[model samples]
Target: MSTPTSPGEGAPTDALGRALRLVSFAMLGGVVAIAAVAVFTVGDEAGSGVDAFGAILVSVVFVAAALFVPRRLVRPWPATAAPNEVKAAGQLRSAAFLSLVFAELPTLIGLVNSFARGVWLPVAIGALFSVAGLLLTAPTADRLREWLARMESAGARTGL
Candidate 1:
């Protein structure tokens, strides 16, 4: 289905979505970057729970600010493409939100491991899945329109 939003019209939402996407992914990437910089920078190991918590916190803070900040600070930019393109922006935004939310669980688990004791192997595996989930659903905002159509069709068949 076609997205109804104009490209730049959803900038506020779009920006938040983009922020969520990048920041969450960065949590994972940052770990790699940090490890490369120094295998042992902290008292705890590089791949410990504290690192994961820090990464997730950074992503959440960035996204929350983008979502709640005044439009003045988060001004809407002009449409990058035709009006048709704008429609998909909302889907992208939604996808970003969902992807980030999905990512948090594994990160949170990893975060907890920092304070407590848990098996890193499972949490690490879960984190990879979370990252994949986020990436796979990045286009979710656009899919909302499609889902709506399916719902409507189902309702009609059921005589609702």
Candidate 2:
């Protein structure tokens, strides 16, 4: 709930910004590592039968959830909360965690499929989704400020 800072105003030096960036990078790193392992171990032939079907089904579910869930989970700032950096930080942290978890889900599913069935497609698709999500939603200072500003504007319009 802190007053939204202008772009390039050095918000990253704040504690909340540092924590958000650290967590965002950690999640991205995990996805990259998993994807790399899966890619490096590719073998002959894709998976078949029930194993293949299950992998496909699970992958679909994970990808769908990844695409849809994070936005819903990142609720707006609470009205009763003090308007301060701590509140802003808490909101940013929550949003970042939700985004990262869903984004990483597909990659995890892909890794499992790759390890169990030796198929590369799922892993590759997962890597693409993971990287895209991480890049698009990574909680930098500017992004956080933008999101908070939007939420604040919405709250104002709704009379919250």
Candidate 3:
């Protein structure tokens, strides 16, 4: 027999999804704000060639790190630790925020370069990389469900 869920039963999950989306938008907003500030302060000025190749290379490395580091941080629970879905869910939330921070690095670097060299190219490159990272890492309801299911199975196995 199955139990009927209340109307507000899924509110937490829905709220989580909304919160993650909000965070994603906030990161994008940061990029926009940086761009606006750069434009207003620098005023269409082309900077004296601040090593375009180097900036692009650094951006690529940071983007790659942003994509890779989160998986390491979200590792499975150790055998000694009792499995708790609530804890797993909290870990997921923490990991998501950390991932966003890593993803935002490119944009922050671009902002620094923009301010130092007074060029827009660095900011644009950084924004592109960060946007891709942010979009790729944004958590969805389906992903949350899958993660919970996986964690439950792992708990079952360990609890046996």
The per-candidate count of clashes, in order, stands at: 7, 1, 0
TM-score of each: 0.37, 0.68, 0.75
Query: Which should have the higher TM-score, number 1 or number 3?
Result: 3
Model 3, which residues run further than 4 Å from truth?
Answer: 1-12, 47-50, 78-86, 149-153, 156-160
lDDT of 2 by residue, 91-122 (tens): 65777677767767777877777777777667
Ranking of predictions according to TM-score: 3, 2, 1
lDDT tens readout by residue for model 1, 1-160: 2223666655333444456556656765754343333323223434555655655555455344333332222122233433333443444444445445554455454434533543343234344544554454443344333332332332221111
CA-lDDT, candidates in order: 0.42, 0.64, 0.65
Least well predicted 10-residue stretch by lDDT in candidate 3: 151-160
If the candidates were sorted by their lDDT against the true structure, best first, what order would they fall in? Answer: 3, 2, 1
The number of the candidate with the highest TM-score is 3
TM-score of model number 1: 0.37
> Which sections of candidate 2 miss by over 4 Å?
1-4, 7-9, 12-14, 46-68, 74-81, 154-160
Put down candidate 3 lDDT per residue, 1-160, tens digits, no spaces.
0111355556345666678779878887887787667656754765545546655777788767766776666554454666464676576677677778877888788778877786777777777778887777767665544444454443442221
